[model samples]
Target: MGRHSLPDGSAPASTGSRPGARRRTIAISTGLVLAVAAGSVVALRSDLLPFGEPCDGQSVRLDVAASPDIAPALDAVAKTAREGAARTDGRCLDVKITPRPAHEIADAFGQRPVDPEFQVWIPDSSLWVDRVDAGSGTPLTTAGTIASSPIALGAVPEAAKALGWPKKTYTWTELTEAATTDDALRLGVADPARSATGLLALARINAANAKDTKDGDEADTRTAAAAKLLYQRVADGDGQVLATLPRDDSGAEQGNPRRNQALLLSEQAAYAHNTGEDGGPDLDLFYPQNGTAQLDYPYTLVDDDETTPAQTRAANRFLTLLSEPGGQRALRRHGFRTDNGRPDSEVVDAAGGREPQPYSADPADPPSVKELQALLGMWTVTVQSARITTVVDASASMANPVPDRGGQSRMDLAKNSLLQALATFTPEDEIGLWKFATYLDGNKDHVELSPTNRLGDRDKDGTTHRDALAAAFGSLAPVPGGATGLYDTTLAAYEKACGAYASGKFNALVIVTDGANDDSSGIGLDSLVGKLEKLADPKRPVPLIAIAIGAQADKSALDRIAAPTGGSAHRVDDPSQIHQVILKAIMAAGSKGPR
Candidate 1:
């Protein structure tokens, strides 16, 4: 089962709609130039087939929206349709087109189901279908023109030559080992958050690392090693550019191999870049020679939301077109080949050709519902990572308040917000509470897990861990306290609370002290960090984090600990903003790859 309480960063809601009549943006290559200039074709075609009454008399209006994140192949598809090749059942075609922001599409699935009335909603990849299913709707029909290019090295001729590419071959192990030895090499990919392709690239790397053992587990040593490699590159400033990029942008150096970039680009962009007009840096796609994984973007027909059987039938017809001989021929023109072809067949040794193999996915085989559930489950471990050994300012000087949710004391607001956030848990995520300024007492440093009694999950023989944790938070009385243990408390939690679950889930050391630090100096903080770092997580410990509420926190200390350990030390000028901010941070924590 997945955890409750949506964390903030998991997926930011769409802010607003773009101006203009919405048009679907499909990734298409230039089919032809406009009659006037014949030179404005940038890259990818942009065309849409006109809609009309279905030849079979079925009024199936498919409002197609391409994932705005990917370049629209609309023009390519449109040009084909204009040639009368897109007719359904040997007649005209009818469909409306609209373009929504990429983020909006991710959000849409979270809120409402794609209109079942619409015959089909094609995102860039079928993997997105998995994410969309995780959210709303009785999943709709999804299809893709081509699956992603299995990740390969998109390097300059020199880089490829140096790696023994076209001459030799590369396996994931070769790449990782090379990076470990030579720190200057760059690997490209798109931002995981921005592009599903990048995320897949990351997953592939993780799986490659995980190949040693196929134990059906959530995380493995290889994944942790890969994440550490990524984070180190991030912490090492912008120096790790060539080593890591989103899976997509790892191409001809993004016109700046001189100055490394943080994110990667999509494989299509990488291909286009190496072959573009300004593209002569000697580019090559080094397919890892030893059995690489291909993303099989299977197109499935949605039958759940149709008025009549004809509309559904029409949708299936489209699927048929995608797999038929003509469609397969079109796929080859766009650099794809039918899966059956071997590296030996007419499968031109080019961008999108290779033998086809059965993917670990099937609309019915793997059960998307189960995968969606798994994604959410892994996500929960990321969010409730650490329970801050929160130390609120309760002294006489701290009594004044700031604006909070509906105007409440900053301290009280902080308490309520923390309570609400704690509520977003499965017996797995837990937190600790403390109040301070002059004196500290009353279950300080007490960490409790969320109780899952509602589902009859007996984490503690009969009591839900959440209930136990809730009781701990409730018992946190604002006693007259002073002098927060900025670093010491954090160090304490490393040993005291979070240490218990360090290996299983993310166990963080959180501190919500008021203002600046009083005693936790550099030397003391160093000692604390050293101890925390030395300790690996428990068999399944959650992550740890520290928060500074209304000052009274060792800024430097909190920052350092959270940085490497997958946590954050946040400073709040106004107390009322506590709830939303903490929630947001939790969501960000969810985005981390396993710790």
Candidate 2:
């Protein structure tokens, strides 16, 4: 739109001289400027331009952060949308795609349960939509399809044959028995805590809170009962439950071999990565010989202060695009079911090689505030896990060596780091404080210290229960006990952080520990992991971050806990580094995704 004057006396063109056609040139040039401006204006307005067209040159960026389960499909759809928008409106559409597992989808946008900042959230189910609504007070305003393959079990042909896939329906008994008795028949599902499919599968097993009526044809499920069932089964059985995953065609990438051999995830997710296209084996799918639950990936809206109207608009547009023909085709290619298309043969085959079952999802389910309350209620109980409770070693071995940096006693550095870590949280972050090293009873018992108010339960002005949090982290004086119960304490910390808090708050469990597992006092690590395995939430996760100090720091164990819980673990090489380590722990805990 910049202006330019015609050079020389072009105006003289009007005065004879083959300067003829002067009026024609002026008219043509003027037309081009107006045309370009009009085109730009039109381009600026559309988000999805229809099929076969390029993205608009001026559309706002439609950055989509999707759980990995649906990212591929969405990315393809977005690209098509960009093309269409461009062709129709002469606009530009730029798309940025990031992938994460389903559980972390909520955290990508908002600070609290009710908030999300992304233009769109494509989690694996309407269940996620419901959970967020409970916290944010509505189904994320943006709408998206709950399009997904039925939640089913995937088994290799040989495994299916052994499990009696076609002849007998596969039941919980089959899965449990395989886990307990058949070491070679490993079961796979993403970690329920991090993946939606895992959580959904657990819900099915626990008959998850199936509504209970006082005396009607009552089949109501109690959340506690379900938790007990799931926790007991996994904790008691030797199942390979993966917490995080390796990204690859066959998922054959190396990891801590002890963690797991298989994963828990949606049937579609399994298909997308493990099938022929990935140049891997032809995975067989089983609908568990049981009725399948539909996994609806809902497009949600984040309502926290961080949300903006553009996000809403972009999200809405994205939803519309998903339903459009171009988006539909792309979703189909990625194994997503469509309103108008053939069932994905891959999905059909893995579904126990059976016909696709009927499926439906209700995104309009009103958010239940009580559900949020219920999830929150679980937090407190999770914290009091029996797995936690370590033995502290106050032996002569303790005082001699230091954790090196700037020469502070290992214990002193750990304490200072913890204190500094506490400050990293603003009033908004929910932090559960716990301190070990001292036994309250002469019998050497670990104390819960004190409890702090729940996160997001703060007053309108945003003040939290500061005093309780302070009391929990009061001191770390070692008591007259055996060696430090590093393993047991870590176990206990896991339960406290993931188990004790209420839902609807950011989960950050920061543990400061010094050495080996010899001083076993609290719950054992295996038992603690057992409890953690059953952990579920329609909302946020209870993240655990730890800092190891002293010459005796058990960095390996700490690292294990942090990775599975979506946090970090570090060894403070020097006393001066403790503060930074603590702050990092706090930040890592506050962060969302993975663990």
Candidate 3:
């Protein structure tokens, strides 16, 4: 939700009691000489200004784009600045504060040319600036910090009291546990890919989980696991995310079951909702003890060749005016703090005499761009339930005993691991089983044991696919001196997966192999990869993940096949580590969409 307008709907008021008041209100635009051409005042366009009609005498125009939350206040400031006929050098200063979606603006910086008139952009946080800078390779100058808001947990008073939020501090782990496992507390958050607040909350959780493990892949794995749980909670429920918040003033109780507990939101948002008359419920703020992400409303200058020197001067003057008492007053009236991070009297009064919690100016560092990219990728996979077809290699090599295990065949271990992996999946996940070996069934190397359907579910034959698959796995034995028929089986499985692509689910094919392709009658590696590449669709992806179970497996060939479908190939020499290897395969299986 955007920032709320002042309750009284008044102009910028003087908050003299604020700590370190800058100066008395000064009207910088009064008594300005009109710039006339042909003895007529130049009329401005209504579309340029977000709110009022254009100023008649204004000559110099400065365009400012701000996030929607603060757009109202900035628009009010611009209107006041225009009414005063503010002057820079010898012409009237006209400021236009256009409201824009933060994500759209970041995307435009890299894919489209920025509008020529925009001189400054004030996004809700420096994160947007970082995104643009990283994407376009253009350096944006940070003018200064305009306002400060921290992401915090907004819990109903009852829930807050149960968690001892205000009385005792809690870490993100504790909070996540309560929401996911400890007590099944409903948790609501925004989509991290789109919401800075959501991203910060998830980042905090990931960092905490990372700190508890040794650095390297172990740390990444732990963080990914924790983030997976967070994503699952949101994915499995509806009406709990920020985008779907209930609109009723009475709030969660007659609104939606998903939103009846703690929600993640910015400090200003929580205060605005709580202070409103007849607002839903009393929300207690929970500030994590390990620190939180702050939105420092970065005032950034858009430096490009298209901007003229005169427009630059006008922009600089507009910023200067905003720093003045009147400009700061407008900001304060809208529940924003001064540039120095001190809340104005208006905010304090709205808080019912309670002071906003102070947080470390230097909070825990946010994830790097690369780390964020990886995290988002992981979330994309785990957020959706999956549909998978497991294709197992039952060639003669499967009968080989594990080098470490005394007598267990590789096939036996693989079968057990597959069963264990099923426990990791929710009942909603759909799965099927297949086996490939030379001349296994009526001269066919590959044959399906069960049809693709929801696990633990009965098919048309009145037999549960789960039981059928388990029976098939337990009874399978290596064909006498059989060879691997990898190419034909993989091609057929890929076709089946593509044909059965399910919407709103991660659809994939998992191939568990023990050796290289030895079938001379089938398509070659190059031809198979080319065909897979051509068949793969970004809009409806079906990645083919391959797990090589032992040391002698052909990893290079598997990589070639998986690369075309945006999947990965994993090699595990130790059969005991198959569980971890399957987790890796699951991540790789669903990783084939947009960045």
Clash counts for all predictions: 94, 56, 0
Query: Against the true structure, whose TM-score is highest?
Result: 3
What is the TM-score (0 to 1) of candidate 1?
Answer: 0.48
lDDT of 1 by residue, 1-595 (tens): 1111111111111111111211222212322113213522311132112233234443344445554422244324433443443443344444454544333455555456544434455554455555555555344433233333344545654555566555565455666556444555655444444444444555555455546466533233354445445433332211123334322334544445443332233334344443345424434555544444333333333334333444444443344334444444554444433443223223234332222221112111122433333333333333224333443444433444664445455556666666766654444444445444322434342222331122223454677545665675555544344544345445554565543543434444445656554443323756767777766353333345556665444567678877656667778776555655665565455543342
Which portions of model 1 miss their true places by more than 4 Å?
A: 1-61, 67-75, 89-91, 95-104, 114-118, 135-138, 142-148, 213-222, 231-270, 278-282, 300-311, 340-595
Model 3 steric clash pairs: none
* Tens-digit lDDT string for candidate 2 (271-354): 565543434334455554344445656554444455444444455445545654566667766677655223566555543355
The segments of candidate 2 whose C-alpha lies over 4 angstroms from its true place after superposition are: 1-48, 51-56, 85-90, 105-117, 136-139, 173-184, 208-264, 276-280, 303-314, 340-343, 350-352, 355-595
TM-score per candidate, chains pooled = 0.48, 0.47, 0.72
Q: What's the lDDT for residue 260 in model 3?
A: 47
Model 2 lDDT-worst window of ten: 8-17
lDDT of candidates 1 onward, in order: 0.44, 0.46, 0.66
On lDDT, the stronger of 1 and 2 is: 2
Which residue segments of model 3 deviate by more than 4 Å?
1-65, 84-95, 103-145, 178-186, 210-261, 275-278, 296-332, 336-362, 398-413, 438-444, 459-480, 548-552, 575-595
